[model samples]
Target: MTLYLLIYFIIIMGAVVAVISKKLINSAIMLALLSIGVSILLFAYNAPWAAVFELSVCAGLITVLFVSAVSLVKHDEENIKENRVKYVLLPLLLIGFIISASIIVPEYFSKLQIFSTYNTQKEEPIGKLIWLYRGVDIIGQLTLLASSVFVIKHIFFKRKEADNGGKI
Candidate 1:
């Protein structure tokens, strides 16, 4: 198998591991690692624009979100209300949905016959293509970056008792 495909497989496994992890902090870190793996795979497949988007939005934005949210929850299982039946049933339902989707979705592009012609010409750099053809998408990405920064700063840097005159 190609290295890119292998990386994708590893990312899938990492995501599964992250989802099942007991500690929320560890799961968040694993998700960041999974995003980095996906970004590297996108870069290897000659989609640097996609790679940058995945790196910034998935890795950076998601990590910031996880860190902010994780801080709100106490790191103790006693605080959690576990429902084993619901947990087991949810996974089974999700597996059924994935199986249905796999059966419905086409594996090869030829099966769908969407494209009329394949272009294999040497293309411009992704940055140039972004500015020329996909400028709107680049602008949207910049907006998202700004919004995420604002949210992160609001969550993590807001004034608290520790900053005011309280002892730790």
Candidate 2:
């Protein structure tokens, strides 16, 4: 219960920071944090498949895409004014969350039946289950990944061309 509350707090704070952040990179990082918190919550709820997918696609892939896009944009960091207090607080908050989670998560998982070592019946292998039962989801995730990569490539090339006065 306490762990769930803490996770919820992290998710909410991350979302608020992501929306209000002035820098694109900060927003992207916050979005990743938010996704990670949600993933942890999903895992605690015994939804491992959903948790993994959320962590991989949202936290991993989308955050990479966001950071890549932000890197492509030209920005003069020296001129942008930022609040130092929030920057300092962010790390402290993360550290506290990590420490608390480490202590609580193991105990929480021990109570879950899914994480238990003993099973009455043998279960299907994870690989076979995913491929056979969730084939369409796998295909969709792959397609989304491919399409996002091409879109980013196109945007980068277009920006370069525009910068070069329409020369590719």
Candidate number achieving the greatest lDDT relative to the actual structure: 2
lDDT of 1 by residue, 1-168 (tens): 589768987897678668667678888989999999999988898878789989998999989988788887646555787764664465577689879877777665457687566678987876688789999998898999899899979877746677888732
lDDT comparing candidate 1 with the true structure: 0.81
lDDT of 2 by residue, 1-168 (tens): 999999999998998788667787999999999999999999999889899999999999999989987887737644667776776576678779989999999888878857667767988878898889878999998999899899979876645566788977
TM-score per candidate, in order? 0.62, 0.54
Candidate 1 ranges beyond 4 A from true positions: 2-5, 52-57, 75-78, 88-104, 107-109, 113-116, 120-122, 137-139, 145-168
The TM-score that candidate 1 achieves is 0.62
RMSD of each: 4.9, 9.4
Candidate 2 displacement at residue 114 in angstroms: 27
* Angstrom error at residue 139, model 2: 5.5
The whole-model lDDT of each prediction reads 0.81, 0.87
